[model samples]
Target chain A: MAEMNRFTRDHEWARRDGELVRVGISDYAQDALGDIVFVELPQPGRRVAAGEAVAEVESTKTVSSVMAPVAGEVVEVNAALASQPETINRDPFAAGWLFALRPVRVAELDDLLDETEYRKYVEELSR
Target chain B: MLRTPLFGAHEHLKARLTEFAGWEMPLSYSGVAAEHRAVRESSGVFDLCHMGRLVLEGTGVAPVLERLAPSRIATLRPGRARYTVILNGDGGIVDDVIVTRESDTRYHLCVNAVNRERVVDLLRKTADGGDTRVADLTLETAQIAVQGPDSAELVRPLLAGADFPAYMHTVRGEWEGQEIVVSRTGYTGELGVELFLPAAAAPSLWQRLVEEAVPCGLGARDTLRLEAGYPLYGHELTESVTPVAAGIGWVVDWSRSDLPARARLERDRKAPEQLLCGFSLSAPGVPRDGFPVFLDGRSVGVVTSGNMGISVGHGIGMTWLPAAHTDPGNAIEIEIRGRRIPAVVEQPPFYTRGTVRQSVD
Candidate 1:
């Protein structure tokens, strides 16, 4: 099965998994925030709209928010981040996923950018 | 923006550059946390060329320094350095400086980069009628710090046969035919040596030292000093706040009557209303500057300096509180992002396993 990833302008990535969607920040986001020391995740079963801040990532000197990519009910969150926040800096795409959500409107995923578009967007931002 | 002589060296090391105090300096090389740990466990090197350096010469230098500062300066022995502050007429701290008596008529002062021009102008005005000469050497010189438990071992081979100065003392030596001054003084609570050399000779020396020592930046330096309980100039020590409120009144030599802020300092020393105090959060949270501090649900003050206590594995910071609430074990709340964190007023030096006074082989 091929995996699909859609990105938001805020640098979060939402991957569709049939009825559920897993969310995490992109590599650029993790790199910008060096050496993550702590993470605050939203509680399971909480509903959030697109662009709502659902999680927080803290570095040695800065704090950044992880926003929800689309409207959904959070089903699960990665609890391991409480003890090992650096996991985000190590594997931001796979094991560092923040939470899983059951989307209220799966069609909203189409509004986000694909891998190619996100790469171009990031390049333009750096310039 | 002003660039240091070692800016090219920092770029070569892929440092994260940022603007600070009108200078483009490196904020971190590898990572702030990693560099901080390196200084604690092994060794680290830092480029401090952005700081202001000054040279004062002539017989009038001693009198001018004694009059402008609260600490005794005229009788300071050669090769000794004392941490003191320049004061305004109102007894407020103008700036914190390290005054090193180089000779009977020569002195070296390291000041904060942001206040360089102000300090130099003030000194020149005060010395107009005297025979003293104040020279701003900031642009012509460079300073580098090698710090940690293994600092001495790393620096000993470079200056072979030269006597290692005791803590708070300075030693003059030659490195690779270039003149240099090594001082056993640092902001971090570690066994460290700060090297003062000519600007043109800085890159080569920095490259040589970085081979064995982790190249650090201002990020780690800030955390290291905070853990050591040292106050930064603009944060804890400011023009409006005197040394008495900042918990550094001991720097004042009260017996002397010729000090500039003698009367105001004495009155504040005798009856202080509020004083700077240190605190640590009961939970794991990062506190930041300007965060409001509360006592019994009433706002008392704001955090002057705060950060994640890297060595202690918690949050630590400093703030002003009522004189009665300045004691250790008092409970307070630090508001972080609209959430108040339960904290307790504790004595500073939040991380105490330092090797500043230890002997290294």
Candidate 2:
């Protein structure tokens, strides 16, 4: 069950799971977006470039995009979120995982922030 | 930013504050969805001090207000209130207001915060040299709205045996020897009362009330009003939008030949090409202000106000469309993020089970 997690400046999170990387938004992103009502996930087998918007999250008042952290092909998508979008607000890390991707360049995860670095980044953002 | 008397209470509860109409107001407490549901099922409270309150006093006050507002002011009996609008020369809406006749010579006006100054200025100029005296009470008073099904039972004990006012009526009461005005009106379509009291005593009363009701914020207020199909000033109404086109032509007293914007209203009533209408999405998506609407491959209008109708469990919005396409069951499309969302034109109050006129007796 051990998985290494990394963060993006756009507030998305990537967890290293075997040869696949699981993606979801950070807790900060969900809190800032407020109660999510709907979510659209990228289709499995869809190829996307780094920083490309692959998902759309709709809250009560506004809509936000979830971007790909690195270039990859979507291997799995979270269909549960289509009916229970609030899961992202309730638990953004485990049960709320958005989609999984097979990374074309695994080295890109090294450039992302770790747990400690991401916490500090979010702290600085508020101040 | 200006702060309401309840600002300290909001800070104490750690509410997320946002700037609204020159005031620092609470956007949410626990969450938007939670607060919205609280008002629908139970009870919730709000600090509405950002709304403007004006007082006009004198025997001549009724005539001045009659000419300025679209509703019949001179015929309004004391203790009664009416929802009406102020208009410009072209019959365009200046602002939507609530006019309450407190007494023979005293009248109260509740207006939107954004148009407070303009409305006050307009009233002053219109009553110049007359016996009427105009006063702005917004900063000196605190307005608190307690709404929902249980609102009456929750607030009745605070007023010390004072009989509850009927809907759109007002009664004067006292809290700790300080005079407070209680009116049966609210933006949320619920059985509620709005209290007006001196600014200094508001925080204490608000603390007592919040203990029994959920402390709601502007986020829930917007959704509740939108679900009730009420129009917001800057959105559904503006200087360029007439009552006829805004689906509020009934407020105008057409029999009065000297009514403001008579010429323009008469013309629009005769032939209204475009009318404001309500729609609900057939698919999943949230329509928002300024998003273009389409009918049969042609762009017709744009959303005036839009939101997720939490109680109705769908996306509902308002838009101006051709009169032919504005009927209750007509089909239309709304473009969101480059996708056309299928929708149907439906009469609003999207959440129709409101207790707004339910008897509190």
- Worst lDDT window (10 residues) for model 1 chain A? A31-40
Model 2, CA-based lDDT: 0.91
* TM-score for chain A, candidates 1 onward in order: 0.97, 0.96
Write the residue-wise lDDT of candidate 1 on B1-361 in tens digits.
Answer: 9999999999999999989999999999999999999999999999999899999999999899988898899889999999999998898888999999999999999999999999999899989999899999999999999999988988886665787778998888667898799989898899899999999989899989999999999989999999899999999999988887788888888788777777788777878888899999998788889999999999998999998878898889999998888889999999988889999999889999998888644
**What is the C-alpha local distance difference test score of each model?**
0.91, 0.91
Residue-level lDDT of model 2, residues B288-311, one tens digit each, is: 999999999899889999988888
Candidate 1 chain B, run of 10 with poorest lDDT: B157-166
What would the per-residue lDDT of candidate 2 be over residues A1-127, giving only the tens digit for each residue? 6877899989999988889889999999999999988888888999999999999998886899999998899999999998788999999998888999999998899899998999999999999
What value does the lDDT take at residue B97 in candidate 1?
96
Estimate the TM-score of every prediction.
Answer: 0.97, 0.98
Q: What local lDDT does model 1 show for residue A117?
A: 100
Which ranges of candidate 2 are over 4 A from the true structure? Answer: none
